[model samples]
Target: MGANDLAKGPQMRTVIFDLDGTLADTSGDLIAAANACFRGLGLGDLLDARHDAGTALRGGRAMLTLGFSRVDGVDPGEVDRQYPVLLDAYARDINSHTFLYPGTMDAVTRLKSAGYAVGIATNKPEGLAETLMQSLGVRGEFASLIGADTLPVRKPDPEHHFEAVRRAGGDPRKSLLVGDTATDRDTSRNAGVPSVLVTFGPGPHDVRALSPEATIDHFDELDAVVAQLIG
Candidate 1:
């Protein structure tokens, strides 16, 4: 059956997470990699984590863009040539300061222990996401991982979340999409699954306006939220 048909069936047994701000605090590595790229090109450091994060591409390309934009001596076209350099640097330093947000691992562990399948759905590239998950020591924990390139389209399309459900071998009617942005909320809505929006990340637009199924301030509240949902 098509992905759209899943949500209408039985309830989901999986919980899919959006990486980066949701599952891991990857800003440090992302920012450091960008700065390193800048220094490598002799442009010096220019972007700050809080502000530059919004400008970075959806994933690795964002880091590449941050670095390329800071290099004063390189031609804009030449930036493409330097992308490989930035990507290599990023992959090498993927988890330098990356860590799970407070209570994230515990929450995931708790969920799995309670028999809920856990997975990841992120805009980050597959390779980078895999590397980060490995570095964080949680690679084997996830039942499925859907990165940006996993499908022809990404978040805000609903397909990605459905694909995540498919990979987890579960139904979406019982699943919840947990993330930190409006695109994620949109994805859940389109997929006809409930979505939980985390407030501790980069949301280029107004999250409240996006109107997720629910909003959370910290990981500590997630368990209670889920309980509320399943009840």
Candidate 2:
């Protein structure tokens, strides 16, 4: 459908988002860092490893663990050692290949201007989430952000979502979680909020199997999804 078709929809109240593949496409830089870690240890680099990283593109740390796990008998310390290299590489090139998904920034800007509370809730670690948002010039863009380490538990546990809702100053009934992973789906369900799943990321299983409230392949479809949730 055309943009005009979507514009006829009613506005939404509050929308929470996932980072990584859902908002920013960090796979290219993350793949570079993961491979840098592998090459630092004198292992043969596989393009498939990078592609594998695309599926679980939560953050640098998760990518590191996923990439390094391919090497059998590798010590956790070795993985730990590689993390600094990844972090250092990413610190310089975080936005090099990472960008907001199409129409994402526009949607976010419109929502904020419409008086809707906006927040970010992702499985990425709390510290890096804040740092990346600021570094990429979208930090203050979110009224609230909840990362994996933000609380004693993470996604798949509803407390994190509850905390994000509290921070965004919205009731769960008026909020929508937009993400691309089963973990995100579970978080929404457990929090008693609606979720919209995007079909554009690496997830271990089919997103539809998780039973999100809605599913779409583009950010352009988000307005209707959000309208249904927050109406």
Candidate 3:
């Protein structure tokens, strides 16, 4: 839809998304990366791809910490020590098991056609996020891609969301965030923007607890949710 043209004027409204567990289900690959780290330490697949998926989506450090907790007499700085290994492993084979959720591309195409600027704001490291998107062949779909290292601060911090909106040439005040976690909900709240939480993530979402502006069970419901929130 030629939606991300930098020369074009800002769209009246914007819809930013969280990458992991939102536009894509990246848990399998993430867990695999952490397992690589554990395997290197002779831990041998400490994390189950299906069971530890929720931790995987949280990020490499979280997965390492969880794995460490299950073991006895582990080094105190093991997570930090293995983080680089995890990232290296993840980057080497980022897209092996990662996949866009059903209707993700369709929803983005529909939103762009409808004149809403779109972008990604994620806690994933910028380079990995960029590589993953490029591998999945949807990097161009987003007008902007901001990551954990993109700014000095990240999610649950308003500027991270604001920067993505600005980069997308859209007004932050008239934007909404679609994500699947409490961090996303807090980011939207901190930005004074509406939030749409997804229930089709690695696990069931406690929507009432997070208390975002809205929730959706699938990407097919996203367009309507976006329109209802910001249009």
Candidate 4:
């Protein structure tokens, strides 16, 4: 039997979400943190939000490394050394520039009201993820928040997705992941679940080209897409 077939009774349905690029535009704040580190080093804004947004979504070290690459004296070791500092800075001001994509709360509310268990499965660190969600006042909406450090491994590694679904009391085979990167697509594929990629994320990838099960340019289209994919 397929996952839905097995879940014919009262088993919970689930929708797993990616945080940074998918649920919210966290690049501005993320970049601010990296820029803070560079400013401390007297570099004074080595990375520009418009240009390095994709790298920002990739994580702190990626942003730091990209910034260091543009300067003469900096090296990879410097990026490593400043990684924690960036995280600390980001943690302090996590919600300053971060806002949910339009229609996010509406879509999430629809899912919850419809009895689907919602959860986050992001590559962001677990603690940071919790802080961000709480800062945004949406922490209680999700049944679970599984992050990079929540388990021994992260996305594209099926275990991460599986754990998120399980924690939400949903069957993995019946779950769907809403994300905005190739990594998220690969994670869904590896976990044997349908994937939906958002086109509005800061990532430079052509989400449609990622060949996710579905592509949504806006959160307004999410409910129908989720229904078609899993229901």
- Cα lDDT, model 2, residue 161: 77
Question: In candidate 2, how many Å is residue 160 off?
Answer: 0.9
Better of 1 and 2 by lDDT: 1
Candidate 4 Cα misplacement greater than 4 A, ranges:
1-10
State the lDDT of candidate 3 residue by residue for 41-160, as single tens digits.
Answer: 998888989888888888889999999898999997999999999999999989989999999999999999999999999999999999999999999999999999999999989999
Give the Å error, residue 184, model 1. 1.0
Model 1: residues >4 Å from true position, as ranges? 1-12, 54-58, 63-75, 202-206
TM-score of every prediction relative to native: 0.83, 0.82, 0.94, 0.94
Cα error of candidate 4 at position 10, Å: 7.3
lDDT at residue 114 of model 1 (Cα atoms): 78
Q: Is candidate 1 or candidate 3 better by lDDT?
A: 3
Sorted on TM-score, highest at the top, how do the candidates line up?
4, 3, 1, 2
Q: CA RMSD for every model?
A: 3.5, 7.8, 4.5, 2.7
- Model 3, position 103, has a per-residue lDDT of 91
In model 3, how large is the Cα lDDT of residue 127? 94
lDDT, each prediction: 0.77, 0.76, 0.92, 0.92
lDDT digits (tens) for residues 147-197 of candidate 4: 999999999899999899889888787899999999999999999899999
> What is the C-alpha lDDT profile of model 1 across 1-231, one tens digit per residue?
988885466454788999987887787777777677677767777677777765542554566665665545556665576667667888988877777888888888888877777889998877888988988888888989988888999897887888887788767667889988767888888888888888877647656667887778878888878767753
